[model samples]
Target chain A: TQLLEQSPQFLSIQEGENLTVYCNSSSVFSSLQWYRQEPGEGPVLLVTVVTGGEVKKLKRLTFQFGDARKDSSLHITAAQTGDTGLYLCAGADSNYQLIWGAGTKLIIKP
Target chain B: GAGVSQSPSNKVTEKGKDVELRCDPISGHTALYWYRQSLGQGLEFLIYFQGNSAPDKSGLPSDRFSAERTGGSVSTLTIQRTQQEDSAVYLCASSLFFMQGILSVGELFFGEGSRLTVL
Candidate 1:
């Protein structure tokens, strides 16, 4: 079983639409991170939520960590075509190794 | 600052051949990790190196896979007797020592990944 499960393996929406992606797990994590990857490039860190119930905003994107530290969410508002990419969530296990989700491919078409 | 970098962006090798992929982590970073991403699949952890200590090789998929970090800077991941199933993009990441499992909160600086195809 995947330690981290991501919902909506794929997403397609028109420009300006808003959406949310989820990452869930029954295990608690020390911290959770979100990344965005474009074709032909490596993933880049978008945000990191450390504390339980913590929320972070990066311009048009918002990230929230579950109060129990077992889940997280990524929301985009007024999405633009540039927002299209693969969104990945990862958690740091107690061993310091990162457990990754399968990633959600988000396509914002104009 | 320069981010992580890998060599031979793309490679194609015959099945049963051996292949070595290299990674150059960011300067001053003491933690390095290797992972593989097969087509349409999630990233799978392979190995990790921290300072002069022994590496964590628990994630290696088989006995044919091995990795070593020299001088705590550059690392090489070797897959012996490569098989078709080994075709995938290999990614490398680096972070500061203190960021191992704490302060930096798992913020990884990733290289542009090496794509290997076993024919």
Candidate 2:
């Protein structure tokens, strides 16, 4: 089974702090996606990166796909309380299935 | 619906009982997927349906778990003799289509999910 290991399973920071969450795997992926989920809701896609060394920024969140396509990272700049949630990373396997990471729970204190 | 829809947002059932979760994908989406999420864990793929092709059941944990998508629109996931381990959020998602080539990636639209609690 393909596994995506995410780092810093739990994170807590004050407002305006910056945080980064990383997802690593031994298997290379064709594409990687980042999602943020709130309580009582399914995850919402934040961004998708397809190429190696790709970077996409959405508002305060920036996502980077590793040069080897075996890892990805999400960086939040000037984090706000609204940025608090579970951040997940998913990669597309050869079978077109999404292999997901355990995710990082982020709490931004206001 | 504009987005994927799941029924019985929350369900509390006995350990030996059976439960069925429903998923209604967005109109015109051809790819549907089922996943289970335990507390503090990532999404675990359960089943996948694409168009009229054979459904992928490889991810189903056991024979007790089965799912079916009818007429290419709505799908149902059934768990028989539910166990405490089956308690989790059942999520359904749909994409316009499955990834076709090396570079194409389908973006999945997810529902609010059905939270099942087995006692």
Candidate 3:
């Protein structure tokens, strides 16, 4: 069974649009992380949130961790073509074991 | 190298053949994990190794799948009698510190992954 689940398995939007991808789970996590991956390369870390109800912003991209630490969301504003790739979320269990989400494949059409 | 390394990057083999995939984590990383991904699918946990403790082999799909981390540095995953269903991209990741308790929720550094295609 998948411990963490992601929504909108595939997304296609025009440049300058806004979109939100969500990751949810029933189990609370000690830490949550977001990663972006391009073809032919490994996923790269975008941010890590350790506290519930915490939000982090990276330029036009905003990430929020749910108050109960059981969910997270990534919102991208004024999406650019460069943002086209796969967005993945991972949660760490008490034992430091990471449970990964299925991922959201985002495409920004110019 | 500065990042985790994996090879051979791509492998194509026939059924019943055996194959080996290798991973070299960044220097000083104590935790290593192996995951498999099908086309456009989520990662599937394979195995995990942390420091000196025995590996967590619960994730291994079957007896034909096995892995080893030698000298607490390099790792190798071996698949015997490969089947077409075994085709997937095998990913390796390492964290600098996971033994320090909840305080240090080490972020994983990943390799590009080795793509295996069993015919």
Which candidate achieves the best DockQ against the true structure? 2
lDDT, ranked from best to worst? 3, 2, 1
The digit string of per-residue lDDT tens for model 2 on A29-105 reads 98899989998899998998988999999898889999999999999999999999899999998866789999999
Which stretches of candidate 3 lie above 4 Å from their native place? Answer: B98-103
For model 1, residues B21-68, the per-residue Cα lDDT tens digits are 999999998899999998756788899898898999989999999999
Per-candidate RMSD, Å: 1.8, 1.3, 1.3
Q: Report the Cα lDDT for residue A49, model 2.
A: 92
**Model 3: per-residue Cα lDDT over A26-89, one tens digit each:** 9999999999988877888999998999999999999999999999999999999999998999
Q: Per-residue lDDT for A97 in model 3?
A: 75
RMSD of candidate 2 to the truth, in angstroms, is 1.3
Candidate 1 chain A worst ten-residue window by lDDT: A91-100
Q: Which model is ahead, 1 or 2, in terms of TM-score?
A: 2
CA lDDT of every candidate: 0.91, 0.92, 0.93
Provide TM-scores for the models: 0.95, 0.96, 0.96
DockQ values per model:
0.67, 0.75, 0.72
The full ranking of all candidates by DockQ, starting with the best, is 2, 3, 1
